[model samples]
Target: MNTIEHRLMELEAKVAFQDETIEILNDEIKVHQQQMAKIKRQTELLAEKLKESQSSQPMMSNMPEPPPPHY
Candidate 1:
């Protein structure tokens, strides 16, 4: 093949490889975004449960503790 034709073929190959890499990276990003969304939802649910548990519990008194025996 001629030098120009060979160079053009090489460039096309590089471009094809780059396109494949971009598609793989895009798929990975989509998976990561879905995972992040699930994690965020779980975190919010846990926070709500924590708040509910805290609210349902009784409050502590401000009274001082008595001294132990054998002072």
Candidate 2:
């Protein structure tokens, strides 16, 4: 085969390999995104539960003052 044809073939092979690598990277990115979304949802749920638990407790600072007795 001629040198030009051989070089072209090698370049084509490299391009194909690069394309496959890009596809694999894309798939990994998608998986990471899904994991991040799941973690975000779990964090939100935990925060909501924490807020509810805190709200259910009574606050001593908000209690009404007792009336003073007459002498």
Q: What is the TM-score of each candidate against the true structure?
A: 0.81, 0.80
Stretches of candidate 1 off by over 4 Å are 61-71
Model 2 segments more than 4 A misplaced: 60-71
Q: Against the correct fold, how does model 2 do in TM-score? A: 0.80
lDDT of each: 0.93, 0.95
Q: Write the per-residue lDDT of candidate 2 for residues 30-68, one digit (tens) a residue.
A: 999999999999999999999998799887579886778
Clashes of each: 0, 0
- lDDT per residue (tens digit) for residues 1-71 in model 1: 69999999999999999999999999999999999999999999999999999788865454566778877
Best by TM-score: 1
